[model samples]
Target: MTSTHADAHILVSMTYASRANPNVSATDFNEILQQAQINNAANSITGMLTFNKDYFLQTIEGPRAQINRLLYILISDERHHDLQIIDTRELKHREWAKWSMNYASPTEENAAIYLKYSTTIGFNPYLLNAESAHGLMNELSAQKG
Candidate 1:
C-alpha cells in the first residue's frame, strides 16, 4: 500500500549479517517467515523481510507498542545484528497484508540497484533508507515473474 503523509505509520528498517551457521538454509528462513506471520497475526502486526546472500532488510508497522515489542525480540535474537532503525514515522495501514520474508539471490542486476541507491542515499539496501528500501522492494516485486 502506498503511504501518505496523513497516515500514522512507523517504519523500522534494519539489516544485519547472517549468522555463521551452516544449517541455516532456505528452509530455515522460510520457517522463520511462517512463524513471523503466525506471531504477528496474533498481535495485529504486519511487515515484510527481504534477504540477499549475507544481508537482511525488514520493515514492520503496526501499533507502536506492539511493533516495538516485536522489534526488541527481533534485535535481541541471535540471528541478526548491526541493526539500524531507518524511519519511524506515522503511517496509515500496512504496506503488506501478511507478514512475508522474501529471499533475493544476489545478482549483478540486484547488486547494481543496491549500489546505485546506496551511493545516492548513503544507506545500503541492507540497511534502511525509505526511498532506497522501497525502490528495491518495488524492483524485486516487479521481477516476480
Candidate 2:
C-alpha cells in the first residue's frame, strides 16, 4: 500500500551526499543528528545517515513535503557543502521503517564494505552512482542492526 501526503501522491525516498564543512566539529555533527532525530520523528520521516570526518551519505524516506523541506534545510545548513543528490523515487514502503535516523560511521572495521561500493582509496561517496550508493546504505544498515 502507498502512503499519501497532501503535497504528494505517495511516499518517496531521497539519497544525497555532501562533504563536511571544514569548520564543522564533532560537537556540531552530534547536534545536527540530535536535531534531525527530533524533527524527523515529528515529521514521520525515517532514514539512515553514514558519515565520517570527511563526508555524509544519507537516505531519507517520507512524505514529499517533509522531504522537500529537509532538502532545503540541508542546502542551507552551513555544516556541509557540495550536496549531491544520488536518487529520488516514489516508495511503496520505507526502507528504513524502524529508524528515525540510523547512524553509521565507516571505519577500519567497515572499510571493506565501503570499498565494495567506493571507487576511491577511502570512503568517498562522491564517486558512487545511485545504485551503488543505495546498496552501500542497505549494507551499512544491515551491519548496524
Highest TM-score among the candidates is held by which one? 2
Instruction: Write candidate 1's Cα lDDT for 1-145 as tens digits.
Output: 2323342344433333333244457776777778887787776666667675445677666666666677778778665566766656566556665444444545656766556556544334544456667677657655643
Clashes of each: 5, 0
Model 2, position 121: C-alpha lDDT score: 72
- Cα lDDT tens digits for candidate 2, 1-145: 2334665557899999999999888899899899989989998899999998999999999988889888998999999999999999999988998999988887777777888886667788888888988888888878766
Residue 117, candidate 1: C-alpha displacement in angstroms: 4.2
Assess candidate 2 and give its TM-score to the true structure: 0.91
- Give the local distance difference test score of model 2: 0.87
Which 10 residues in a row give candidate 2 its minimum summed lDDT?
Answer: 1-10
Error of 2 at 46 (Å): 0.6
TM-score of 1: 0.67
lDDT of 2 at 53: 90
**Which regions of candidate 1 fall more than 4 Å away from where they truly are?**
1-23, 98-128
Model 1 lDDT at residue 143: 63
Each candidate: RMSD: 6.8, 3.5
